[model samples]
Target: GGRGGLAALRDTWQPGPGPLAEAQAILADAGLPGRPKVWRNRLTQGNLQLRYGRDARWYRFTRSGTEWRMDGPPSASPVDLAY
Candidate 1:
């Protein structure tokens, strides 16, 4: 069944588990890997902040609703997202 196949694919493609579990799941469904390292409070109203790291670089992200944008350069300090 087409619906069953879709559900199977969804289940198989889900992320294992980590810091940004929910966000990672959502991004995985959307074809992007989620790697949320830090959560910040930007001075802007109604904006959610996210910090992610990959390879050896960190990135600051700003999320407005479902949309996301990069805010700054990678962090110089090492962050452990597993916490």
Candidate 2:
């Protein structure tokens, strides 16, 4: 059997403070919606905790803000994208 989703995310996702910043920049450059805010924790496999506004939701890597489909998108709204 394989590790659970959260375990897999914790094992595979390596978003250092630097790389994470760069990823955000890429998102900004691509003009994608939603902001990558504070990283809560690896929620599950193929999903991560993205803080936006006063809430945090789990989102997959490929899912975009507009495609979130839920009442609110899953990406984070960090205080500073340059962080």
Candidate 3:
């Protein structure tokens, strides 16, 4: 899943801005703010995670078909995450 798949979303992870609006929308619908202090990729295909707000917790995001979803409320960012 690293060759392409959702990994391509990193194209917006540059110094300026990122294309997380759509991804954020998913979080918004779940009552989670659409902002992140840090964004990182997961070795799992079509999966991503972020840390936001006052909590240093990490929330997992998964892609199903063409849509992205929140794995649940923010949990601690695991030490094993790829990035």
Give the higher-TM-score candidate: 1 or 3: 3
Candidate 3 C-alpha lDDT tens digits along 1-83: 22232333333233212323333444444433333333443223234554232233333556678666555544443332223
Clashes of 3: 0
- Global lDDT of model 1: 0.34
TM-score of each model, in listed order: 0.31, 0.33, 0.32
Descending-TM-score candidate ranking? 2, 3, 1
The lDDT of model 2 is 0.34
**If the candidates were sorted by their lDDT against the true structure, best first, what order would they fall in?**
3, 1, 2
Misplaced by over 4 Å in model 1 are: 1-46, 78-83
| Cα lDDT computed for each candidate against the true fold | 0.34, 0.34, 0.38
Per-residue error (Å), model 2, residue 27: 0.8
Evaluated at residue 52, the lDDT of candidate 3 is: 30
Q: What is the lDDT of residue 46 in candidate 2?
A: 25
Q: Highest TM-score, which number?
A: 2
Q: Can you list the residue pairs that collide in candidate 1?
A: none
Alpha-carbon deviation at 13 in model 2, angstroms: 7.9
